[model samples]
Target: MSDGKEMRRPGGRSARVRAAVHQATLELLEERRWEEISIPLVAERAGVHQATLYRRWGTMPALLDDVVDEWSSTTAALPDTGTLRGDLEVYAAAVAAPLQDSLVPLILRAVVLEIRPGEPRTPSRAFRERERQLQAMLDRARDRGEQVPTLAELLEVVVAPLYFYALFSVPLPAADAGRLVDRLLGLVGQKA
Candidate 1:
């Protein structure tokens, strides 16, 4: 993590280097695939020496993981409205707004280009983390006497379409988003 340069460390030199490296990685990712990005490129982009990037991240995968984790964590926490409908609407807005971000499409497109169909695809840690968040939301709803089908199914039926439309260039009208939310709450009500 030293990057061979003595950085003043109030927070510590390592933290500073990591932040710089992440910023550089994110900038590079906007224009190139992960495979095309090299350690030297990251170091150059960050204005650090190449050894520093290696010392901090060790490999491209490690660097990209840190970048994605940092990016994913920036989303605001979902609101907990009393009703399921209200909560879903708030959550939908949070989820949908991110879809409109330019970087999201770039990252998703990079991922798609990197993976071939029929290849065994590992689920991203972010995807699992999001599912966990949704599950927690479901648990909260249940605790509030609001029972619903498994959050996975509900998310697949509702939230997944928003992302799918964004990725595939399908038109996701506000009415469609509202209808999906209605269907999700309808399912919840039926289950209750």
Candidate 2:
């Protein structure tokens, strides 16, 4: 493993270093706020030099963005259950699974900070891309004769409360979060 070659890819040492750095970043986030995280700290935790982290991620925000992007991409494929409730429950389960990870709540907290007090919040480009993928799953239910709502403005409504509750207090247990997903999915129009 020390050779730094990942069998699945060709990037070798650089890739291994990047993975180690990201893993260290996540480990640190479990114990500190994003603002408190620094390249030097990440390098120290990762056992790499500070120059390595800076060379790879450039800035704190850039590093944070990569971490979030990796998280979003690693999730399992969204389920298609024909019924909106079932489909959403599957989606919720995948989402809720990460909430149990100590690092995840911190990440969620950081995301909330990205919002401004009195402005129309725009989804980050990565988030928008991920949402489009989710929406495509929703569209599949529609194609299968399930009723689907006009989702142009409903994305935030669906996810905001979940994040709010998790970031604030009493993070919803996985089972409870599943129930919330079921309830929220019910609110969306579903075919009989």
Candidate 3:
């Protein structure tokens, strides 16, 4: 029976293509600035047609947004261990690990600072989502009778310093994670 509607083929081909493209993007990011990497370069690196990339990703910002989303999906997540301190320790380790990745600062700068011409500054809201996740976690602690401060306060005391040290190429002192977690807990009336 022939129907008017066309049925697309079902396969894992799209997944394979996305993996190839995203991996190629990571490789390119290591050697190229966000503005310098084009669709042709990504396609050549991935062994895919430029047209395919253009069709699939739509624009350079869109593609980069997707790449960053993939990276965050794989790496960035809030810790949900039974207690707040355990959760913060888990997140702190992640921050330290990624700070050493050469690409991390560059990617962070581009996503946070660069405004793509003719497009939204952030096609992905990874930063905002991360903040929201932090807020939700804090809200949970507050619900559990912990006196948590606002997210802004938490960031000022706990998160910003790590980022500052990372941006300046300073190695995180081994005690920094525990110290910051303690300070954050202290703000929430939880003595560590």
Candidate 4:
């Protein structure tokens, strides 16, 4: 890479606009369902023009998608701590901290409760990204010679609890994550 100080995005100002709109969306989501929120309301709350929202995102689903993406961004990457225990702790923290965020519950509820018969499976891009990230983590564990199980197993054992507790607004027990990793590794050890 060329001593990277000069690369600039084409729409730096628009980034601020996007953040404003996303925040506005979250604020609106706190008070109303997606059906009740509108572009005009979001624009007013964000102090951005309705035309800007339309020009950038074009529709309600699209705008909601962006907001969800930003919120989900926290789950974008998992740390490659050399041990499975360390990795799972990082994962636990990532999943747990967002449960307290004003927006995570709304996003999770919409995904779990608001699906229509013919719509795409999950509108939350972050959920989809998390699946991919989880897979990578599993593969890393296996590559490191840890006795990891399938992604489904990991999900049921670890990720499921993370999401379940968060979605339900329950605080995770401090030892729960560590205990989960212990169970996971024990299963692997037993298998071998």
Candidate 5:
């Protein structure tokens, strides 16, 4: 006695399956380079049928995109330090800390290079998530009657350099985060 519409349950089988698959993917990523991982390997490690993965993710890039999306969302927590400069410094440091891990750059490269024929290029989920976090911080600054740089300006002046260092496997010292925040605020005619 079932209707045509599919019913979804909260914290049910789908969530459990996704968690298992994501964990397996992360484990594989830690153990090997991105190029060496395959769907069959992930399926076996996750203990889920290969067909389930294929049906859900469609391809390896799609699966990796999902994995990174989840990872970024979980790790990026917005800071409320009562001042935009303080918030930006904390956020920048958080961003730099993860790039110190060896696997992050490899995963980022794979995600950046993934191209689907019919799909128009867009920013990665991690980028969008960062933008969202920045937006919240900017909104708070505005509420406190502080002038803040435009989101694009912040991304270019502050975020780009931090990410560039990570992309090149350069060491990003914690002090650099504070320096970047100072530079961004100074450029926008605000005190750091």
Candidate 6:
């Protein structure tokens, strides 16, 4: 017990380090392409030793995967507006808002590229979360005797277009969310 070394608390220092690394990763992502990011660069930006990055994340892809997962999980909350159309409108706007951030597309691309078959991927986790939210909204509509499109229909009709525009860097106006919801409702034979 005579050693002069300071012992780190279980979560205190660890949590701070992780947060700094994540923030640094996001900042770097905004300024540079995913391919250009490296562990040493991230370590320098995060003010952590390179060994910390290596020990915590192991590799660049793994670090990027963690970053993407963290970012996706913090996205807009699921909207519950009673009506499916109302829910979709709010959800659409929320989803579209993040695409306006330059870092989002890069993170999305990294998620897509780093996804491995049979692994618990960020996209799969995100999809499952969306599925659960959509299911709840659809169930509510059906219970109220309101006709609603299936989850797949909503994904294809509404979510697909929003994501397509985001990935392609297309300008998605705020009004587009309402229009997208209207288009989905119209396609499913529901009055907008």
The best candidate in terms of lDDT: 5
- State residue 140's C-alpha deviation in candidate 2, in Å: 0.9
Report the C-alpha lDDT of model 3 over 1-192, residue by residue, as the tens digit.
142232343235677888898878878877877678889999999999898899889877788788777766667677788677777888877777666665555556546644556667555376776788889888887788767778997788877777777666664754677788888778767777
Which window of ten consecutive residues has the lowest lDDT sum in model 3?
1-10
**Backbone clashes in model 6, listed as residue pairs:** none
Tens digit of per-residue lDDT, candidate 2, span 73-133 = 6654567677766776777666666777655576665455544456557766555766787
The lDDT of each candidate is 0.69, 0.68, 0.74, 0.71, 0.78, 0.78
Off by over 4 Å in 1: 1-7, 10-16, 76-78, 107-122, 170-176, 190-192
- 1-192 in candidate 1: lDDT tens per residue? 253445355357667777888778767876775678899998998888897678768877777766666656665455778867677777776656655545555545544543435655776666666677778778888888866668777778887787777688844654457677877767656531
List where candidate 2 sits over 4 angstroms from the true fold: 1-10, 80-83, 113-121, 152-158, 188-192
Model 3 stretches astray by more than 4 angstroms: 1-11, 113-124, 170-175
**Considering summed lDDT, which 10 consecutive residues are worst modelled in model 1?**
1-10
Q: Is candidate 3 or candidate 5 better by TM-score?
A: 3
lDDT of 4 by residue, 37-116 (tens): 88999999999889879988998777766766665564436888886667877777665665666445667765554344
Number of clashing pairs per prediction, in order:
1, 0, 0, 0, 0, 0
Query: What order do candidates take by lDDT, descending?
Result: 5, 6, 3, 4, 1, 2
- Stretches off by above 4 angstroms in model 4 are 1-10, 74-76, 113-116, 119-126, 169-175, 190-192
Better of 1 and 3 by lDDT: 3
Question: Which residue pairs show backbone clashes in model 5?
Answer: none
| TM-scores, each model vs. reference | 0.74, 0.78, 0.79, 0.79, 0.76, 0.79
In candidate 3, position 52 carries an lDDT of: 83
Report the candidate with higher lDDT, 2 versus 3.
Answer: 3
* Deviation in Å, model 3, residue 125 alpha carbon: 2.3
- Write candidate 5's Cα lDDT for 1-192 as tens digits: 142232556347678889999888877876887788899999999999998899989888888888777766676677899999889988888877776664456556656656445666766556677788788889999999998899988989888888778777585876777888888899778965
**How large an RMSD does model 5 have?**
4.0
lDDT of 3 at 158: 75
